[model samples]
Target: MRIQRIQAIAISLPLIKPVKMSFEEVRNAENVLARIETDNGITGWGEAASAPTMTGETQGSMVAAIRHLADKLEGLPADDIPAAMHRAGQYLYGNNSAKAAIEMALFDALGQARGKPVYELLGGAKRMRVPALRLIGTGSTAGDIAETQKRLAEGYVAIKIKVGVDTPEADAERARAVAASVKDDKVLICTDANQGWTPDEAIRFVKGIADTRIEFFEQPVAAHDVAGMARVAAASRVKIGVDEGLHSLDDLRHHHQLKAALGASLKTIKLGGLQAVHDAALLCEELVMKVNLACKIAEAGIASAGLMHLAAAIPSVDWGVSLSSPYLADDIVAEPIALSGGYINVPTGPGLGIRVDETKVRRYTREV
Candidate 1:
């Protein structure tokens, strides 16, 4: 089958609560959704949440790239999704989020045509369910503690507490509250400084909480500072995980050589798309390291489903994945992803497995 049409939309879905990282606070999910239609009448859906700070992409760029590529994708054969990605790459440069959105749709189409789930398309799935870890913002310590307790009560066992937005002492206290709260439970806490701390500050904060159960430190230093990351990793007892730092294969190689981190957080938009994500996970495995397959926050069902399939197929993504769509005020899918006992059941149906709620998507669609 060949491509017939590609439709794209930009949606601004409000968050249940604003998510504040060290750099920006977002109240709504600025996401782009895409649907690819084949000549045989089968269609597949995809979504993207771009981050200028992380993926160096904005919603406008994603929409523009999708519109530009639609003309070129009209006749590409859908039997080989990787070839579709390569052809899409030829029409756009550096619009990974845009390309990722299209790749997701292509994979969805391929899965449906083959009567297999996207995970099965990647490789036979290793798991049928994946766990989600709720993230705590850098707003209030007491609030953060209460939120952690609330999520735990709702069956979440892992929480990522934001650090580095405050002073070293204050960040320690913020993390301590959540770590201490889970001390008696079978839960683990992770600290994500979002590259908000200096190497010295990261060392100090981790040392201060050295007695707590904080499992790992994520992006403690700046994204571009691999040397600082190495220094912080060397100085801290808690293992470090890189997020924004691993933007390219060379970046991964550099960090691996320095032994800067034990694991990395991979996102579809930042690395290009599923093909690139698969490559990165393999590289991590080559180094005997783990990877946390995560999505941009507030992604709609299409993006979430893509991540679930990827996490299911990749062995090194043993680190639990996060599905933040459930935390949104609303989702643009007929069947929202279900998270129970900290685990989300992967969709077993063909394509992304979740169906888009087009009416809701239209209501949430933002002006281009």
Candidate 2:
């Protein structure tokens, strides 16, 4: 099948509740959706959340990027995803979030045409069902502890406590209380500072949590501060994982070299697309670094499904998979991807394995 048309739709979907992180509080999910039509009349969909703090792409920016690339990619063969993406890269630099949306649409269209799932196109499923990593940041120590207990009761195998919003000592106290709430010793516990701390502050936080069962700490300092990251990593017994700091395979290598982080939170918004994330995961495996596959703070079902496919095919989800569709009050899919007892089963159907609800999409659509 050949590409016929591509249109970018911008939407603002309501979140179930605001998610508090170190950088910003997310009240609503502002995202851009790419609708790609093949000559054979197959319609495929893709989405990306506008994460200015992470990818420097807003809803308007992603929409414009998709519009800029649409005509350039319109005549390319639908099945030749790599060629199409390479052409896009030649015409544009950065804009990984926008590229990810378009690349996801191409994969969906190709998978539909070939009657295969997106995971198969990547490689093959290493595992069918993946553990869902729950975020426990209710903005209070008691709230966090209660939330952690609730999530643990719901069967979440992994949990990430949000820190860096307050004093490192205060956040550490909250994390300890939260971690103590989880009675199951098998549960994975981690923390993400989201690049919100100084090296010394992060080191202090890790020191406070030294006796806690928190598995790893993520993005403790600024994204560009590899030296700061290295210092924090050295000061703490907890393994550091990079999030905002990682944008390419080279970033992974650099972090590995400096001992900045022992794991990374892989996101399409950071890496560009599924292929890029898959390649990064392969590299992580080779380096023996842990992997945390995730969507941005709030993405709809399309991006969430894309994550599921990646989660299915990636070599290891040692840090667990974080899906954001569950945070949305409404999703643009007929059946949204949700955690069943805190675990998400990968979509097994052709393409993205979810039906796009055009009506819902239109309802949520906003002028960009």
Model 1: C-alpha RMSD to truth? 1.4
Query: Can you write out model 1's per-residue Cα lDDT over 13-35, one digit (the tens) per residue?
Result: 98888988887887889999888
In model 2, how many backbone clashes occur? 0
Span of ten consecutive residues with least summed lDDT in model 1: 315-324
Identify the leading candidate in terms of lDDT.
Answer: 2
CA deviation > 4 Å runs, candidate 1: none
In angstroms, the error of model 1 at 304 is 0.6
Return the TM-score for each candidate structure.
0.96, 0.99
Q: 250-330 in candidate 2: lDDT tens per residue?
A: 999999999999999999988999999999999999999999999997899999999999999999999989999888899
